[model samples]
Structures are given as C-alpha cells and as structure tokens.
Target: MNATPTEMMTIAAARLLTNQDVCFVGIGAPSAACNLARLTHAPKITLIYESGTLSTRPSVLPLSIGDGELCDTALTTVAVPEMFRYWLQGGRITIGFLGGAQIDRFANLNTTVVGPYDAPKVRLPGGGGAPEIASNCGEIFITMAMGTRAFVDRLPFITSFGHGKGKGDRAALGLKTKGPTKVMTDLCVLEPDPQTAELTVVSLHPGVTREQVQAACGWPLRFAADVAETPPATEQELAVLRDLHARTRQAHGVAA
Candidate 1:
C-alpha cells in the first residue's frame, strides 16, 4: 500500500532511531514515530516523556504528555524534577523529538505566538520542556508537516534554539549538545548545512519535487548537490504503522 504523507514522515523519522538511542519523546507526530520505532526495529529503545515516564512503551499513541497510557505502560516513573535534573541534565538522553508552530531557516522554533507577543494572531501552547531538550540532548530530530506558514523566514519567538544563528553558535552559547541534526517533514528530510548551519534538503520523499518543497517553505531553500530520493515505506513498515494507528484509534474510541 502507498503510504500517506504523514505516515511516510513518521516512518522516515522512525528509521533514524536505533535500539541504542534513549529518546526524549514529545507528544503528537514525535510520539507516534518514537513508539513506532519501539514497536518495530528498535524494541529496546528507551522512551522518556517530560511527565516523568521513563522507558515507556505505550501501546496506543498518547494524546498528551500527561496521558494516563504513558504512565501505565512505563517501566517506572520518577518525580518531574528528577526526570529533568537527573536524567536530562545528566546527559542520558541521545535524541529529543520536537515539533513547533513555526521554524526559521536556522531551525529555531516558535510555539508561543504567531504574531506579536502582546497582541498575537494565534496563541499557541507555550514551549514546556523544549528549550532544555534542545540544549541537552545529544542530538535533536524534529518532525512536522511542512507549510509556508510553519517553515518561516523568521520565528516570532525563539522557543527552542536549533543553531542560534549559524555555525559554531551552539558552542558559542556553551551548549555542547548537537542541536537539531535532522528535520523530517512530509516532503523531505533536511539536515543543517555544515558550513552555514542553514537547513538543506538531503533527500526528497518519493514523488516529492524540489518545487513542491520550495513552495511549502518560507525561505530560499537549499538542496544537497546529490540529493537522493527517500526510500518508500516498505510493506512491513506500512503494515506495522497502520496497525499501530488502528489500535490507537480503537483504544481512544475514535473512528478509523
């Protein structure tokens, strides 16, 4: 079966994870991708949520960080402070999965407001743990559907820093961790340009064109010299992913 764009994005993100990775998972697409990795190839991958669930193996996708399913299936739970101070700040997490309402060319994200801070066009949920996650994770993987509004030239606010301005910015800011190593979107996989720290398309999803990706982005996009076509989702991956979503919908009492 042909994979939907959302499924393709999720599966693409999932493939990047490994059993060795201890991922700090966010809710929504990132949660689905992490859980998919756990349910499939990366069975031993540890999934930690900001709500203090450690090594969680939720059978159904959670609605939020506070969802009961996360705690129920977690191997153990700890105090929020311990989860942040001991686990996150201690540098145990290998990857952090994040998404945002708006992201700039530098991958700096804004989730606070769409317009002005005081008089906003849209008041998005403020960043909860993303700022720390962006700073401390060994590397970050972002997953979000692309749109001109979301893939912006500038963010109204910097909720999470990817590469503050350009190359060496993170080090200059005294953040040792690698910020946003990869951004997986419906159309393509983007990696930061080594020299400039600007996002550059490394691969396009099957049937996705350069024009389509550019049209969706708010900035002048860049592509690698030898950009590759992403491998289409395999039958087993689609089967597993669909089944997971099916179970989640059934468990959540949502129509398929």
Candidate 2:
C-alpha cells in the first residue's frame, strides 16, 4: 500500500533514529515516530516521556504523556523532577523530538498563542517541557505538516528556541546544545543551513515539487544545492506503522 504523506513523514523521522539514541519524545506525531523507530530498526533506542516514563516500549501510540500504557510498558518510572533534573538537563538525552503550532524561518516554534499574546485568535496549550528539551538535548528533530499558516516568517510567540535570530544567536544566548537540526514535514525534509542557521529544504518527499513546498511555506524558502528525493516508505515500515495505529485505535475504543 502507498503510504500517506503523514505516514511518510513519520517513517522518515523514525529513520533518523539509531539504536544508540536516547530520545526525549513529545506526544503526538513525535511519539509515533519515536515508537516506530523502537518497533522497527532502532529497537534498543531509549524512549523517555515527560510524565516520568523512562525507556518505555509501548505496544501502541500514547494519547498523551500521562497515558497509563507508557508507564506500564516502561522499564522503570522516575519522578518528574528527576526525569528533568538528571536525565534531560544533565545532557543524557540524544534527541528531542517535537512538533508545534507554528515555526519561523530560523525554526523557532510557537505553541502558545496564534494571534496577539493577551487577546489571541487561538489560545493554544502552553509549552510544557519543550523549552527545556530544546535547550538541553544533544540535538532536536521536529515533525509537523507543512502549511503557510504553520511555516510562518514570524511567530506570534516564541515557545521553544531553535536557531533564534540567525547563526550565532544560540551561542550568543549561551545555548550549548544544537537546537533544531532537522524538521521532517509531510512535504519534505528540512535542515538548518550550515552558515545561516535558517531551515532549508534538503529533500522532497515522493512526487512533491519545489513549487508545492514554497507554496506551503510562509517565508521565502531555500533549497539545498543538491536536493534529494525522500525514499518511499518500505512495505515493512508501512505495515508496522499501520499496525501500531490500528492497535492504538482499538485500545482507545475509537473507530478506525
């Protein structure tokens, strides 16, 4: 079966993980991708959730960080304070997987408010652990569907710092870890420019065009010198991902 764009994006993100990685996973798409990696190629990958589940290997995707399945499947559970103070802030997490309501050219994320701060058109859930996750992780990977409304030139509110304003911004701000190294979208894969720190298109998903990517982006998009085509999802990847989703739906008692 041909993979949907969302599935392709998740698989692409999952491929970036390694068995040696210790990932601090966010809920939603990032959760699915990290779990997919564990269920497939990166079986030994350590999965940590904000709710204090450490090294969890859930059979299905979790509805939230507090989902009981996470703790039940975890090798061990720690206090939320310890999870942050020791594991995350102590530089033990290799990757921070996240998604957001909006992202700017520099990859700064906004999940707070859509419009003005005080009186907003959409008051989104405030950033939970993302601020610390973005700052302390060895590197960060983002997953979100691309759209003009989401890939904005300016964020209404900066929820998590990426590259900040430009190249030296993170260093200037005294951030020691790499902020956002890659952003995997439904349309393509983006990485920070080596010099500029701006997000640039490095690979287009199957059948996705440069024009389509630009149309979806809110700013003037840039492409790498040798942009590559994202590999189509393998049968095994699709099968595993589908099975995971099916189980999640069944467990949650939702109609598939």
Q: Which residue ranges in model 2 land beyond 4 Å of their true spot?
A: none
Winning model by TM-score: 2
Model 1 residue 113 CA deviation (Å) reads: 0.4
| Cα shift from native, residue 94, model 2 (Å) | 0.8
Write model 1 residue lDDT over 131-225, tens digit each, in one string: 99999999999998999999999888899999988999999999999999999999999999999999999999999999999999999999999
User: Which candidate has the highest lDDT of all?
Assistant: 2
Worst 10 residues of 2 by lDDT: 57-66
Error of 2 at 42 (Å): 0.5
Clashes of each: 0, 0
Tens-place lDDT digits, model 2, residues 1-256: 8899999999999999999999999999999999899999999999999999999999988898979999999999999999999999999999999999999999999999998999999999989999999999999999999999999988999999999899999999898999999999999999999999999999999999999999999999999999999999999999999999999999999998
